[model samples]
Target: MDTDVIICGAGAAGLTLAVDLARRHIRFLLIDKAAGPFAGSRGKGIQPRSQEVFEDLGVIDAIVASGGEYPVQRHYTEDGTTVDEPVVVRSEPTAAEPYRIPLLVPQFLTERRLRERLTELGHIPRYGRELTGFAQDADGVTAEIAGPGGEQTVRARYLIGADGGSSTVRKALGIGFPGRTLGVRAVVADVLAEGVTADAWHRWGDGTAAQVSLCPLYGTEMFQLQGPLPFDVEVDLSAAGLTALVRERTGRDDLAIHAVSWASAFEMNARLADTYRQGRVFLAGDAAHCHPPTGGQGLNTGVQDAYNLGWKLAGVLGGAPDALLDSYEAERRPIAEDVLGLSTRLLEAARNRDHRRGREVGQLDLGYPDSPLSLASPGHDKGVRPGDRAPDAPVTGAGGLPTRLFTLFRGPHWTLLGHGVDRASAPAPRTGLRVHTIGARGDILDPGSHVRDGYGLASGRWVLVRPDGYVAAVLDTAGLPAAEAFLDSVGVRPPL
Candidate 1:
C-alpha cells in the first residue's frame, strides 16, 4: 500500500485526524481540493467536550487565546436602541468539569491552529488535490486523485471521508444519506461593520422570525452576520448585496457593512448516513452526519469523531486486530444518530423563539455506553462508569507538584488510574498504557479527597480511561485482568 490511510477533506475533521496521525507516526495523506484554508466563521462555538479534546491534543492554549466566552445578545429595534439578553447560561468551573462553558473562536481560526499543530508534527495537507474516485478490494483501496497538473492513482490500506455534506467518497461508495431538509433558508456571512460594538452580539426583530444578527467574532475584527432568506428572493453572495440585505433587515441605515469576507446561503439540514463504513472506506464528520447549526454541534461533533477514530486507527496500523477498526462505526454511528435528533430539536426551539441554550448543548454527557469496547462492573456503578466521560480532578505529582487528571490523560496512550490504592497495588505499567495511583502513600496524592469523592471511589477502585478520555472499564483491584481483557478486545498495541 502507498499509505496506511488516505483522508479526503482538510476541514476541521481532516486536519484534526492528520494532526493525530502525524503524532502517532502513522503513514497517511491529507488532501483537500480547496486552494487554502477555509475562510468562514460558520461554526464558531467550541463546546466544553471539544475543548477537552483540544487540551489532550496539545492545542488548548492556542484555541483559548484565539476565542472568548459567548457574549450576551443585545436586541435592537429600528431606533438603534438595544435590550441585552443572555443567550447562553454560563457555568462555574468545578473539580470534575473544568471547562464548564464553550469558547467562541471562528472556524477558520480553529483550522489554522490545527494546521500549525500539524506542521509542528512534521506534516502538512496537500491542497488543490481532490479525490476523484476510488475502488477497494479485499486487500486495500486504490484511489484516483486529481490535481492541477494531472490525475494520479494512489493505494492505501483505508480511505476516510472527512469531506463536507456533499462528500465525494461517500457518494462514490453509494452510501445512503437519509434525512430531511428543513424549511428554513438563511444566509451566513463574515463582514466588517462600522457601527456595531464588539462587546455584545447585536440582533434585531422578535428574536426569531425574519431577524438579523451580527456577532463579533473573537480575536478578529470581523462579525458574523446571519439572517433568514426569503423563498422568492434570488440569493446574492456578493459584498454589496449582503450589505444591502443587512441594512434592510436591521432597518438601520447608519450601520454600514463596509466589507464582506465569506458568505453562503444554506438551507438547514439534518442528515445521517445509513452506515459509516463500507469495506475499507469510512465516512466521518459531515460525511457521516450533517446537523443543523442550531446547537453549535456540527464542527464540534466532527472534531470528536476524528478524536475517537484516530487512536483506533493508529492501534490497528500497529498490528492490532481488524475488530478495533470495526468498533469505529459501532461506537460513532449511534452518536451521529443521536446528535441528528438533538440538533433538529434545537432548530425547532429556535423557530419557536426559545433562544436560551443550556448544558445539553455542550455535548459533555455524550458517550458510547453500548460500545463493544466498554466493560461494565455491576457492583460499582455510582459515579463514573464504562462509556462515561472521565472527570478531571486536581492531584499532586512527585515532590508535591500540582497536577491534574487531564494532564495525565493528555497523550497517545491509554490511562489506567488507580484510586485509593497503594503504589504497589496499582496495575503494572504496560507498553501502550500508563498506570498512576492516587491516594495516601501512592505515586500521586489527592490532597483534598477531590479524586476520592468526585470519582465515587469510597473504597479502592480502578478506572481504565481510553485515549479518547472516556471510561473503558471500572473494576476493583482484583479486576486488573478484566481491564486488560477489555484492552485486548479493542486491540491496544504497543507504540512504535
Candidate 2:
C-alpha cells in the first residue's frame, strides 16, 4: 500500500490525526479541499483535555502562546446600558487538573499551528486535494482525488473522513447523519469595526427581537460577528449588507463596521453519524458528528475524536489486534452522542437566557468507562479508574528532575505508574512500554505524595496508562496481571 492511513480534510480533526500519526512514524497522507488554511476565528475554545492532548503532541506551547483567555461577554440593553458586570469564572490549575480554564485561539490559527507542527514532522497537508470517491475491501481502501495536478488514485490501508458536516466519505459509506437543525439561523462574519471595546464580548438586542454579538478575536484586528437572521428570510451576505444588519440589529449606527474580512451563515444543527467506522473506512470530527457551537464542543470534540482514534490506528497498524480498531467507534461514538446532547441543551439554555458554563464546558470529565478497553480490578477506588483520564501530578524523576505525570506520559508509549509499589520487582522496559515508580524504593520520586494522593494510590498499587493517556487498568499488583490481559486483548505484548 502507498500509506497506512489516508486522512481527508485538513481541519482540526484531520490535522490532529496527521500530527499523531506522523509522530508515531505511521505513514499517512493528509488532504483538504480548501485552497489554503482556513481563515475564520470560528471554534475558538480549546478545552483543558484538548490542551493536555496538545501538550502530548508537543504543540501546547504554540497553541497557548497564539491565543488568549476568553473574555466575559457583556450584554447591553436597548438603551445602550450595560446589562450586568461581566465576571469570568476561572478554575486554578492544580496538580491533578493542570489546565483548569479554556483557551481562546481562533480555529484558523489553531489549524495553522497544527499544520506547522506537522510540517516540522516532515508531512504537509495537500491543499486543494479533494477525495471524489472511494472503495474498500478486506485488503485496503482506494480513493480517487481531484488535485491541482489532475485526477489521481491513492491506496491506503484505511481511509478517514474529517471533511465536515456534509462528509463525502460518510455519505459514500452510507452512514446516516440523523438529526434536526435549529430552524433559526445566525449570520456570522469576521469584520473590522470601530467604537467597540476589545476587553469584553459585546452584545446587543434581546432574544425577542434580533441579537448581535461582536467578540474580539485574540491576536487579530478582526471580530467575529454573530447576529440573528430572520426565521423565514434570506439576507444578503455582503460587506454593505453585514454593516446594515449590524446597525439594524444593534440599533447602534454610531458603531460602524469598517470592513468585512470573511463571512458565513450559521444554521445550527445537532447530528451524529449512525456509526463512526465501517470496514476500512472511518469518520471523525464534523464528518462523524456535528453540533451547535454553544458549549464550544464542535472543534474540541472533533479533536478528541482524532486523539482517541489516532493511537488506536497506530496501535493496530503496528501489529496490535484489529479488534483494537473496534474500540475507536465504541469509545468515541458514545462520547459524541453525550456531547451532542450537551451542546443542544446549551443552545436551548442560551436561547432562553440561561447562559452560564462551568466545569462541564471544559470537557475534563469526558471519559470512556464503558469502553471495552477499560478493565478495572476489584477493591481499588477513590480517584481515577480504568477508562478515566490519567490525571497529572507533580513528581521527581531521575537525576532529581522535577516532573509531572503528563511529562512521563508525553511520548508514544504505554506508562506503568507504580505508586508505593516495590520496584525491586518492576517489569523491565519493552517495546511500547515505560515503567516508573513513585514512593516505593524510588525509581521515580514523589516528594509531596502528589502522585500517590492524586491517584488514591496505596501500597502495592499500580496503574497502566494507555498510549493515548487514558487509564487502562489499576490494581495492587506490581506484576500487572490485569494490564497484561488488557494488553493481550489488544495484541500488544509487553515483556513481563
Candidate 3:
C-alpha cells in the first residue's frame, strides 16, 4: 500500500486526525480540494473535553493562547440594553476538572494550529490534492486522487472520510446519512467592527423577527455577525446589504463594519450517518454526523472523533487486530447521536428565545461505558469505571517536581498505572505501552494523595488508560496477564 491511511478533507476533523496519525509516525496522505486553508470563523467554540484532547496532542497551550473564554452576551433593544450571562456555563478549575470552560477560536485558526503541529511531527497536509473517487476490496482501499499535476491512484490500508456533511466518500461508500434539514437561512460573516464592546457579545431583535448578533472574536479584530436571511428573496451579502442589516437590527448607525472577511448564507441541518464504517473505509466528523450550530458542538465533536480514532488506528497498524478498529464506531457513533439530539434541542430553544445551556455542552462526561473496549472488575465499581474520562490530578514526581496525571497520559501510548505496587518487582516495559507506578515509593510520588483520592484508589489496583484519556480497564489483581488479556482483546499484542 502507498499509505496506511488516506484522509479526505482538511477541516478541523481531517487535520486533527492527520496530526494524531503523524505523532504515531504513520505514513498517510492528508488531502483537500480547497486551494488553501479554510477561511472562516465557522466553528468558534472549543469545548473542555476537546481541550483535554488538545493537551494530549501537545497543542493545548497554543490553543489556549489563541483563544479566550466565551464572553457574556449583551442583549440590545431600541429602548434599552440588558447584559445576560454566557449561554455556555463556566466553572472553576479543580484537581479533577482542569479545563472547566469552553474556549473560543475561529475554525480556520484551529486547523492552522493543528497543521503546524502536524508539520512539527514531520508531515505537511497535501493541499490541492483532491480525492475524486475510490474503491475498497477485501484487503485495502484503492483511491483515485486528482491534483494539480494529474489524476493518479493510491492504495491505503484505510480511507477515512472527514470530508464534511456533503461527503464524497460517504456517498461512494453508499452509507445512508439520515437527518432533517432546516429551511430557515442565516447570513453569517466576519467583519471589521467599530462602536461595539470588545469585551462581550452584542445582539438584537426577537426570535420572531429578523435577528442579528455580532460577537467579537477572541484573538482577532474581526467580529462574527449572524443575521437572518430574507425569505423569498435573493440574499445580498455585499457591504451595502450588511450595512442595512446592521442598522435595522442593532439600531446603531454609528457602528461601522469596514470589511467583510468571509460570508455565507447557510441553511441549518441536523443529521447522522447510518453507520460510521463500511469494511475497509470509515467516516468521521461532519461526514459521519452533522449537527445544528446552536450549542457549538459541531466542531468540538469532530475533534473528539478524530482523537478517539487516531490511537486505535495506530495500535491496529502496530500489530493489533483489525477488530479493534470496530470500537471506533461503537464508541463515537452513539456520542454523535447524543450530540445531534442536544444541538437540535438547543436549536429549538433558540427559536423559542430561550438560550439556557447546561453542563452537557461541556462534553466532559461523554464516554463509552457500554463499548466492548471498556472493561472493569465485576465487583469493583466504586469510582470511575471503564469508558469514563480519566480525570486530572496534581501529583509530585522525583525531587519534589510537580506533575499531573494528564501529563503522564499525554501521548500516543497506553499507560498502565500501578497504585501501591513495588517498583523493584514491577513488570518491565512492553511494546506499545508504558508502566508507571503511583505512590510515595513508586516511580511517581502522590504527595497530597491526589492520585489516590482523585482516582478513588482507596486500595491497590492497576488502571489502564487509553491514549485518548479514557479508562480502558481497572484490575484489582492479576498484574501482567490480566492487562495482556485486555490488550489482546483490542488487537494489541505486546511482545512478551
Worst 10 residues of 2 by lDDT: 80-89
TM-score for each of the candidates:
0.96, 0.97, 0.96
Residue 128, candidate 2: how far off, in angstroms?
A: 1.3
Model 1 pairs in collision: none
Question: Tens digits of per-residue lDDT for model 2 on 362-397?
Answer: 888989898888885678868788888998988887
- How should the candidates be ordered by lDDT, best one leading? 1, 2, 3
Residue runs of model 2 more than 4 Å from their true location after superposition: 84-88, 494-496
lDDT of each: 0.87, 0.85, 0.85
> How many backbone collisions does model 3 have?
2
Error of 2 at 367 (Å): 0.6
Model 1: CA > 4 A from native: 77-81, 207-209, 493-496
Candidate 1, 210-304: lDDT as tens digits: 68889999999999998888766788777778778777777767788878899898888899999988988888899989998988999999999
Error of 2 at 201 (Å): 0.2
Q: Which residue pairs does candidate 2 place in steric collision?
A: none
In the order shown, the candidates' Cα RMSDs to the true structure are: 1.7, 1.6, 1.6
